[model samples]
Target: MKLAASRYPLRVATACALFGAIAVAQASVTQVSQITASHTVQQLAAAIDAQIAAPRFASSRWGIDVISLDTGRTLYAHDAGKLLQTASTAKLYTAALVLDTLGTDYRIPTQLLVTQPIVQGRLEGSLILRGMGDPTLDTPGTNTDWADQLAAQLAASGVHEVQGDLIADDSYFSGPSAGSGWEARDLQSWFAPPASALSVQENTVNLMVEPSRVPGERARLKLDPADAFPRVINTLTTSAGNTRSDINLYRAPGDMTLYAFGHIAAQSQAQTYKLAMADPAQFAGTLLQEALARHGIRLKGALRVLHWPQQADIGLDRAVVLAQVLSPPVMDVLTRGLKRSQNLYLQNLLQIAGVKARASAGQVADPASGFLTTEAWGIRALDELLGRIGIPPEDSQIEDGAGLSRQDLATPAAMTHLLVYLARQPYGAQLRDTLPTAGVDGTLQWRMRNTAASNNVHAKTGSMNDVRCVAGYVTTASGERLAFAIMLNNVVREGDEPSPSRTLDAIMEQLAAFQGRG
Candidate 1:
């Protein structure tokens, strides 16, 4: 049945205004307006099905699951059980599992330990910078100045000189440098940096390039956090006119050499790129060394990297702690991860979950031979947690904690089930609060604007090449809360042929305006 224009005047008008001429070409406004103010479970399902059946999505694989939060009844289901690539929406599972395994108030610690006591500010064996998988340590935008803070603490402790090496201890997490199934091209991008126990600034460095004042001259380069590592080879030439900026930056795997090539318009503004660090532990050590030098503290020995197992066997029980920095609580970290879909934070949380699960199971993690053991434990923990929550273990194809891996897969039904289960738990409210509100904040800020779903949907958005998804809660017009999941895969982007997002948004709007079983 086609929708009546008069019945949903606001939605029709908003849709037309938001989508402009494309709305008429892409959406069946007449068909949508035929939907009535009141709907039964069957009617709502039919309405959603009609929208998804639109010509734009005819070639795509689409799945959706909607269930009533109050009645625990399925309102609509369309291929909900079919597993598909979840993109960043997989962070939902990681977030919930971490919160369930590790309390919300838990904080990761980064500490400085001295191997030898300072006698009259002269003698010290070594200074160890130990990390407990704190992803937030020395973040770029955050107000935490841990490097300076550590230096200050050392100066206050009468430590003017270090007789030994400054060792970086990042043994908490053991696994492949990058997440499982991450594309090789993404390794150098900020979103897929190597997962290290002692990551700083998300294990990325920002490089800003400005066109030279004179045409034909090499463009100027600047690096934030100014370090000598990741040496930059600038071969850019400044050109005149409105030429396209073709600046390219490439970093070899397991190497610090950055090659910058191509041209920049002399009149163009500076461009900044965030490049992943090949060795985060060493990068952090270099930064700390510079910080210490600025504070007049001298280290006679070279900087070194050490694992925790090595430190443990040394039996330095009398080692003194110079300073320690604590990360923001787990809740804050979860919020940042969910709201912004941060891969680094979520991956660290997953590794932490793995560590905690191993500790709980009385299995001592052997850092030497336990490569990827923590990550394995984390994946198993998530599977076990899902089983306890009524989701079949096989429903989710878990890969890395962050959804950056192409191997990650989850069915709409599985994700919706997870959401429904979380809604009844004590942490459910907090979890809901972390999601992006439609048209209000986070990734959803610009989505569903000026529509019924605006400000009424709290959900997570996922996107990758040929994939788009959203899964979360929506408050209906009659004050009913519904948990919904929508996944679209193999979607082709061609010219102005209306994105699959439009269909998803239209379906959500209908769900928002639905008043079921009045």
Candidate 2:
């Protein structure tokens, strides 16, 4: 075969060499493009790190974790194992636990029971209002008309008068009125109302104040529901012109009096103040009485509260059901709790879960058994939920269902793990739909506007005096879904600069623009 080498063979060998060079150049270009893409992702990480490491966050503690949902890969992590105060972001765990345990269709029931049957338009025994910790009992501006419906039912049943007391059976939840570790100063504020098994209007009263018709006169005051326990003491004087309003409202701990002082400008708009009620059971009882009166149903006795301990020996077998109102489904409760960061809704959910857990285990009826309180049982249920999702017990420090307590803590890794686990469950889509979308709805409506993260990120935000956090899902530019959590504690605001939220927004925007290697 080596016998004849002609001019044509040399030309063929040269052509082969040219083709090999072209293949080598193409491979190099592909390698360079991959390297550039990797570098871009790295640059994004570096930029986020720099922002967190800036002077403003020098004295603060932060935990960040981001994972790709498509590949289960860690995109970035910084102190991901560190425990931090979660603020309201802790509601995510509560929402998920409730949704998983109770299911999205579960509904809390509020029932009307009569101890004796009605005869000749009169009931011989007491009428009981049994509450199973329904937080949506009496929401303002919404006409559930539960009371009206109950009245109608009573009329239809020929119950013209009740000979005994209107009793409230709020024994479903038992423990301290508020969560453990709650600040005493916040007791009278609308955000920290007492948790009752029977809650009405979120256990708060809305007070509206208007400037007097003339200067130097007292400001007029009005309360919504008109029957909340707090009495108003108005000492405000209206001033002339558009002077800056100096209205002040104060209510002492465990007090039923609201003091409104200082001056309100005549041209100023009417201001509304929400004050927490002391006894939610009594508040609910009063509302029901009023509602009954409106329905022409007369009660012969006063309102009273009956607890489970007192009725442990007396059975409810003789009670007859007159009417009942089922609360909105658990899905609505979870949505309101997560999107609006409502402490009352989450607290009630935890209580309901506790009751169900105890009842399921057959431990609620035994007085000799070392039964846990509502708060304690709720914590246990959440711990069990976390264990099922592969998160260790040491990763969380939950003292209450709501994050209003200072004792609540969670690691970023744990939060991201929860998000990842939730995304894979059967009810994951419903759970995700409850989150606040970036600059679109819920708590995130005013954040990340006009940016890459806008309308693309669905997250839960947490904030307190010195704590800020955000955790949820984000859809990247490359069509990859991601789970992320960022928590900053003990953050101090610097002079004239924006809050730590801006830094968080910057990090989220960067993540939104990320394009992983295709």
Q: Encode model 1's per-residue lDDT on 1-518: one tens digit a residue.
A: 22222222233243345446444433443233323443667777777878888777778899899888988888788899899999999999998789899988998888788867688885458888877788878764552588888877888888889998888878777666677777776777767787888888778777788998888999998887677345778898998847877777766666677777778899789877666777788878887898899998999999987643444432346666788778888988888878878888888899999988887776554433434467788987898899888898668888788899878999999999989988888888888988888777777766677677878889988878789999999988888889999999999867777767777877788888888642
Q: Supply every candidate's count of residue pairs whose N, Cα or C atoms clash at under 3 angstroms.
A: 10, 0
Name the lDDT value of residue 291 in candidate 1.
84
Model 1 scores what on Cα lDDT? 0.79
Looking at model 2, the pairs that clash are none
Give one digit per residue, the lDDT tens place, for model 2 in 1-518. 11121322233344455457446544543231111112355776787788899887789998999998888988899999999999989888888778877999998888888878688999888888888888888785333577787777887899889998888878778777688777866676677887788888888887787987898888888887687763777788898857877766666655666677778899688877676876677777777787889988999988987654455422367877898888888998788778878888888888788777767657656332686887677777888889888999788888888789988999999999999999998988788889898777887776676666878888989877789999999887778899999999999886777668878877888888777631
Superposed Cα deviation of residue 17, candidate 2 (Å): 74
lDDT of each: 0.79, 0.79
Highest TM-score against the true fold, candidate: 1
Please give the distance, in angstroms, between residue 386's alpha carbon in candidate 2 and its true position after superposition: 1.3
